[model samples]
Target chain A: MKPTARWIPYFLVAPAFAIFTLAILGPIIATFGLSLTDWDGFSTPSFIGLENFVRAFNDKVYTSSYGHAAIYIVATLVLEVLVGLILAGLVSAKRNTTFYRVAFFTPVMLPLVVISVLWSFLLNPDLGILNRILDQVGLESWKHIWLGDQSTALLSISVISGWIFAGFYMAIFYAGFQRIPSTIIESARLDGASELQLLRQIKIPMIKNLTEVAVLLCVTGGIQVFDLVYVLTNGGPYDTTQVPTTYLVRVVFRDQQMGYGSALAVILTLVVVGFGLIYNKLRTKDDSVVEY
Target chain B: MFKGKRLIAGMAVGLLGLAVLTGCSKGDSADKVLRIATPSLGDSELPVWEAAKASYEAAHEGWTVEFIQQDDDLYSTVGLPTLLNGKNSPDAYFEWAGARLDQRVAEGFAADISTDIESSGLKDLFNDGAFAGYDSGGKLSMIPRARDVTNVLWYNVDMFAKNGVTPPKTWDELNTVCAKFKSLKINCFVQGNKDLWTVGNWGGHIISRVAGEALYAETLQKKKPMNGPEFIKGLTVLSDLAKNGYVNESVNSIADNEAASLFFQGKAAFHPIGSWLVGTQQDQAPDFKMDFINLPAITDGAGDQDSIMAVFTGYIVNAKSSKKTEVLDFFKELYSPENAKKIADSGTVLLVKSLAGGTLDPLTAKINALLDGAKVVVAPPDTGFELPVADALNAAQAEVIGGKSTPQAALDAAQEKVAALK
Candidate 1:
């Protein structure tokens, strides 16, 4: 390529960069700027530097909501990655992986709000099919007020969110599994390696990059989850299901505390982006040492 | 910080300049359309608006009426402000007549129609309390279309008869009724407390019943501390209801609309909700023999037994719009007894004192009588207070109900939080 052609590459990317500047970076910078001012959507924004952040640290609801987000992110990550990998491995082991893959991926295709609402009815303590089935199976004691009880509400919502996105991770892992050389797996099997041993030693190690991608997607998605929780619990039953987004919405729109909510948004972005950068840095260093 | 302010100011000026340029390019129309936005309830209100629009357009020449219907959530969160920003703003909009309207008025969105409403002899047409929310500093920003009684408990007659439980007249009697329903594996009162507003409404009724509307309002306005003895005791009644499982076990899981659905499905014997439920019940369960009753007075309580929690829900004109004359003409036609009759026929309870007398169904007539006997009406906490304070009160109520905090502790926490709100 000519030296001027390299300039053409930058020129070609300018529109995308401008769009990003206007759409993403602008809002993020505006939010950070607004975090220092007490604006209620209307009226002049009065600068209240560090007050919103200071209040956020002292505010029990704010702190607890972030804790809930952490819980939701961790729970969703474990369920999605672990279950997704298992389902991917099981489906790939079979000759007819197409049907299984399609079936697993169906939930991801459905709207998150619709699935959440559907799960709400299914998990309802009264007249829900879940409780009815439990009654018929003589496990009536196991029936719970799934989205109402403080102890179970966050976990139950996480389970639903994880269930919806599991298929996406599953598809990624299945593709990862497909990329594994058949000879390596065959040799492992010939060496008397069990299916579990083959999966742990060969398949998983070969899919490290795909696994990393899956983890990153799951973590970011889980951290920013709003619609399912909003549709189902709405940060209720004593705000037990409150994540940052739900509480931020309450602060911004409902409560009209725009500055405080902006602070929350900024903090959430930092947490998510910070985690991504750290993970990338560590992974990049490890890959450099691999000397492939 | 100064740079940031200047940048934002520059952006605002640029936007305003752009809007002015656009306005000049479009030019003004001789026959202007008076665009009115209303939230769609999928009920009789839409038809009423249509009828009003037609009637108004017929009377006024060289003018048009446009009804922009929005979903309730969008109307509040985005539509209201977007419509009010002096760019293609609707001449008028329907909004809940309370703190929401108050907020709009404070933000200079709601026009004060006090003189127009009164001089036109229209103010006399509505009930005194109909203007309670919109009236401030001798100005009426909005007029109510209907008086919503939100705290009354309605019982299914068939369920009550089958269970051999009569409507309770006191707190102890209510407990007995709940126990009877429990024995029959039926929920006593169906509640969707997850929304927090529902819990707040229930708490409002109990608080009004115990501490009276005067004290409740005072406490809410911060004229009196919310952590007072009366307030704590009133909240205890609500805590008892949740802790004792008088409400549905999954009360905190379901949405308010879903809880009402469960009530209509005969899953619960008693449903405590606003008068709006009557319209929904008529639509959803036409044959369900339901009768409305007041929340039983607490024994030795200071509040009047006849008093109920009632508030107005209605429309406000956009102060920023240039179509005030056209909007008033529409309101005049809309508030006429003829349209009021249509609204009443649609199963809504009207609070227009002049149009109060109507040929209504047996159930509605019964509810109207119950409303008439009310000595003093109280606003629901959610509608009465600012959103942040209301939200704080709701969270506190949830804590008390969920057994996470004692009633006193919750109230104390709420008092502190609300006091801190600007």
Candidate 2:
């Protein structure tokens, strides 16, 4: 390569590194220094060593909130990828699919805060239209406590989450399906094979990389779902709906426990990195089986 | 020498600003100017900022009164805590009792005003037992809102009379009335426990009924274990109400105001709420005829069957304030019978000595009279825990009502957290 061409790459990368250091690395470094101290954002920070972490580990609210985040991520991610892949296959099989595109891709565009506020009213016990529908169906007994009871609160929030984002996953899968040549699918279908036989034998083997990408996105997004949960639940009804992000805000801002809250943020980052490692390992094992 | 030089610099800048400050700082004040900061819970008396600026101007003819009001404005949204940590904060901020006050006192975020109170003549006026209820370092950290308010069980007089149900006096009687109302398909009690404090109110106030003022105060304010008989009895009363399905089903996120809407709609026959609701109702639900009744005593209660659990809001001037003397004088004027009457007339049962007649809401009057007659008044039992402990207990209430944990388990969990506050 010419000397100037090599320098072009460095010039191109400088802005990106500047942004990364200022935005991401700056906060991480500040938070690390904070985690080692006892600062309530006012008094001079004293070296407290690991006291904040000690308290966080024992704090029931923190533990309960992370548990909610785990359940929220696992349930939503699995459902989105599986349901999304199927819808994508159905759409991509048809020629020139504008209708399918519109039908499956609009809901994800709506803002999450708007969805949370809308659902709060929709699930209200007395004023809500949901119970009214139950009454109409002669299922008054099944009208059920919706947001109030501990049993249904987590699942209810998950359903709203799934309903909002499934469309985006479907669009992702549909794009991945389009990238594969039609001949592979046609060649398999012409062999007098059943639809399921075609799906399992050819389609699945062809789009494994796209499936990995979809799973990765779903895992990352599911793990970080905050705005909807924050507005709707605020980690209440006895912390059954508690999520880590909500608790972090309460500690750092409302309780003024900046050092302790920073410790929680660092731990949460490790959890997301752990999920990424598991996904990468599974993907590597799947990729080892190369087609001849 | 270095410290003296900086002090001289500070004096130079402070002197450079006397013209601006002579706005709120009166001539007679010892020296300092005062700034007041408050999270504005809407007051019709002053549309928050306008009222604050106007009143500060009126009272502080010479010195400046910087009124930093947090409305729905984003400035307050982001600035409240950061500004609190600045070299100086508001000389006085309007304060309401409970964690809002307790948390500040515990964090060493507030200035001690015991000396100012002793000198103000207002101390003797306030020389009642209110200050003795809860003390921090043997000093009254707050000058409390004038009257004691319990969560009153308010019912529609017309509805109770027509239904042939006398209001309930005991936990069993409450259950019976609730059952009768269920037969007629009416919600007997209204609450919103989804957010936790609603459940805290369930034990904090109703527990006062079951345990009586003395024992409830002993356990809640005195740091006595909740496992004892009085605390156990109080939890049992709340758990029974929850078990019977007597509580309004809409409570999770249906805020307190929404519950009031239920009574206005006549969907619920009674609401267990603070006495101040009468003030809120006159403006929010004028057509509804509301009446108050005490929580029926558990037999062999503290002093009288009529006593109610109550909390008070209070005010204090900054001891470090340069205008400390002026702020004290302004407060002394602010709490006079006439001005305090405005507070009472506006809504609260004024803490200043008894105000003129019409200013008192009938329900407010009765609760005040009831307190006057009582041999003992209980602070809600759970608040006696130190700051973090009280908060943890308040937070754990959600689990108790959800049946995720037993009352003692919940209280114990709260107690453990309280003990950990150190």
Candidate 3:
């Protein structure tokens, strides 16, 4: 090869590398540098060493925000991923499932802010339709302040997250199920396998890789949940629903504690990276690719 | 190989040229433009802003005035700061006249507009008290526009008349009225604490009344512990209201707009909020007749019984802007007596003394009267003090109201947070 050929690959990759450095890598490094200083986004940043990290450790609300995020992640794993798997299986089994598919995926098409605002109205204890319906059905005793109570606020947000994204996971699983050969299903039916048995034994097992991907997506996405919680509860009813992102935003913008907020951001980044690593380690290495 | 090196060097030179050109384009027309940043105004208020923009531009040949409007909550917190730090920062921006303005001044975002105000004849337009808190150690940093009574007990006039209840004058009378409303299956008061500031403002006033404004200031400014007996006593009032079901059960879930809707819909007897509710009521529920009273006096309280929770709001010229004279000129036209009357006619209570003479809407007049009657004026925690300290107290108030924590325990937690801030 000519000397120019060796530089061709570098030339081709230069733009992308430069963009990545400017956009993603630069901000990460800047945030880490910021984490070490006592800056308020305006004044000269005084080097505070690791004081912010120590403050984070001792900050009860900041530490509790991680706990809320953990709950949200666990809740979304079952609510989004598992529920999505069942929905995909059911939709795959039936003929002319277009209506169900569209209805399920409709929320995924709308913005999360719009969805959150809509659900906030629906869950409103006084004027919302949810409480009104309960009253109408003579279930007044069952009506509770869904987003106000500490016991229910975070879970309500998690369920709303599930509601918005379950369809997304379902679409992925449905696509995976469609790729399975019809002959295998035909043989199973001929062997007297019930529809439930076919779904539980064959279809679900076949979509294992898709389910794993969905679970991973849900876990990472759950850890960074912000807009939905922000619009709905705003980490309120006494910070019961405060996740790391919401807390980070409050500290950085509302409280104007840029250094502490940057520290929180760094900690959140580490957490998300740690979770990704753990998920990778625990995931089964089933190298057997399904043939078409 | 020589050709390849030439090609690489040419590309590098081209990229450098493009970067310089791009940078030049940003400032090409920047000198002739004046940008104003403010919270998104209502449709009725937009015309006033547009008129000001037109007037300012018409006065200066080859000049343009730009407005960057953002949502109110976002504007105060993240939006204005982001804009100030951006490539094309505003020449002037709207801000509350307390800790937030102090912050902007400290961060070098606010200009010393005292000379501009005096030279432009804008100083003589308003009452002497209008510019009360717009300065720091005699260096005026902002042009005062509106004197807002931030928290008032706004009640439906018709609801009060029909229910055979008069506006309460004391804490016991307030409780009796709430009890009467409760017996009739009505929420005596409705507040939305989702954003925390709604209750934060109201609770701040109550704290001022019970604990005295000095201690309230001390606690929120981190000079004293928040878990003091007076602070606990003040929070107990809020907790009792929530526990007795005087306020809506969904106070912590719903937004302030939703709570106002409930009051408008006659689902609640009273709504405690800022003076801006008059404009909101006019826009959202045009036919809803509402009147407000200062918070009822607390018996045996340490603070002035006639204290009012309020804040002045206005615009500050950007300290870093080269267009300070132009911004002041624009304000001269925007806040002229004639324009001030137009704003007052639009249901806003202006700080202009001339416009305060029997020109305001009845509800706004009542609010002005309440402000006039106040013996002590206490600023809300969120606007009057450091945000982290305000947030701690607000969260503690929410905890007590939500039945999540006792007033003592909640205040203890808040004290801990405040101490951590130091």
Candidate 4:
């Protein structure tokens, strides 16, 4: 590039960079610094180095919330990934692609907050039709309190969350499916391969990148699932549903222990970055398998 | 090349438009705005907020008054620290209890209200017990608002009458009454502990009974470790309520409002909630016949059942605001005979003397009378409670009731956490 053009990219990017630095980087720095002290967010933060980290590891709520998150990650990600792959396999062929694409991706259009609220209302006990239907079918004893039961509270949150995002992943897989050359799938089908055989043997291997993306998205979403859990459960039914973000929120906001909350946030950020990195490395290795 | 030039011009115009928009939002340079932070949206504080802002604006006429109702975190966390930063702060605000405000005063963030109290003749208006929290190097930094009554045991009068289940006069009698209520298919006592504060049942009486008033005072007053036999017994009594099915099973998963609604909606016989339940009843459950009595004698002790758990919410002035005198004047105006009368009329048994109890809605009046008769009042057993004792009580007990944890293990774990709070 010429001298004038050399400055063009910098000028073009400067505003976005400045905004990101202020909005994201500044707070992260402040929170990290604050995490080192024993501050109640008001006092002259007594420099209690590593105490917050020590305390965070010892906190039962932290472990419990993370454990719940671990369960959610496996369940939601696995279901979404499996369903997305199957749907992508069935719809990869060229036939009214727009309709199939639209049908597969419709749920992604609705906001997660709205989905959470609508589902919670649908699952309400006394007034909700969910229990009423069970009662109508002469299964009155099977009527459930849904969100109010400890056994069902976290499970319900996970299912509702999964239902909201599974379609989005399906679209991702379908996009990856379309990117695969038509000749390869046609050749496999011509060789008398079944649909499941094609999916298991041919299509999935071709769309490994898409599988990686779906898993990564699910992992991040699982780690940071706040609004739905907050609106639906508020981390109750005995805190069986509290994830790290919500638990950290309760600590920082409700308890006013900014130091402890920041420590938890830092741990959460590390977990998220770590998970992202491991998946990235795994994907890189997987991609290296099909260099051809 | 001409199209590219036009595109550059369009981008420049967009940038200028954003700059102008940002400049416009920079807002009036001289408008004095007070950001009044609060715990929740639905609180009695909102009315006081509206009335105070109106009074301030009416008095000042030129200045703009803003009520920035923050989320639950702001009051004790972001709001307090932001205000204490001394450059940007609220002019006047309200806070609850001593610990939060005491920290503020110690940090020199609270404006000394000694002169304001003297000049405005506010000293005479405040009662003796209200004087308890005004200490700070012999200058009052804050003024008490009103007493928040805790440790109320509300039993369904209708349920008791129909089933011959009389109100308990003693802990044993309370147990018997619970048995009777259970036999009649009543949930007995209703509370939702999913949040922890729901664990503050009527059984918290064992604290006063076993530990006695002086030891309870010693613990809170002296910052003693609360893992003693008395406290354990108190928690055991609370656990026993769970064991006997006195505490509703839905508690672990249910919320405060949900549990209270279940009670007033007649799902339970007794609900040990704060005195504010009277206000809730006045607003939501006017037809629900109920009676809120004090704790029964847990140990056949001398302490009357009339003793209650109470805290005084206070009005605090900001050290950072320039309109300190104006805000103080506005506070005096707001708390004057007219507005305090409005507060009393809103069903708050305020510290203001000689205010009529306003027909006292029969059940509320009975509770208020019993409260008036109390020889002493205590908190809901938990003091300087990190989360409001009432809220934590609900959450801790809900976990136990939900089968998430055993009551003893849960409370022990909760107590360990509570004991560790600085």
Please give the CA lDDT of all the candidate structures: 0.80, 0.68, 0.88, 0.69
Question: Candidate 2's residue-wise lDDT over B79-173, tens digit each?
Answer: 54565666667777655455445655666656677787778666655535657543456666776655555566889887899999898777568
Model 3 regions more than 4 Å off: A5-12, A287-292, B1-30
Best by TM-score: 3
lDDT of 1 by residue, B1-422 (tens): 66865786799799999999877876445538988887774666678878888887788876788888888777766566656665677888887776677777887888889888777677777876666656755578886666678777888898888767788888899999998888888888898887788778878778877887789888887788888999888889888987887787777788788888888889998888877787787778888778877888788677777787877677788887777767877877877888888777887756786565668887678777766666687778877776777777777887887778998999888987877665
lDDT of 1 by residue, A137-239 (tens): 9998999998889899998988887788778888988888888778887998899998888878778877887787888888788778899889889988787
TM-score of each: 0.90, 0.78, 0.94, 0.83
Model 4: lDDT equals 0.69
Off by over 4 Å in 1: A1-22, A285-292, B1-22, B26-31, B41-43, B118-133, B349-354
Cα RMSD to the true fold for all candidates: 5.5, 7.6, 2.5, 5.6
Residues B162-264, candidate 4: write the lDDT tens digits: 8877778888988998888788877888875545554554444446655676665555443554555555555566677788877766565456677788888
**What is residue B132's positional error in candidate 2, in angstroms?**
7.6
What TM-score does the predicted chain A of each candidate obtain versus native chain A? Answer: 0.90, 0.87, 0.94, 0.88
lDDT per residue (tens digit) for residues A1-292 in model 3: 5544677788789999999999999999999999999987767789999999999999988899989999999999988888888898899999999999999899999999999989988999987888899999999998989988889888899899888888888899999889989999999999999989998888888878777888888889988999998998888878888999999999998988888899999999999999899989998766774532
Q: What is the TM-score of chain B in candidate 1?
A: 0.86
Q: Rank the candidates by lDDT, best first.
A: 3, 1, 4, 2
Q: Which candidate is the best by DockQ?
A: 3
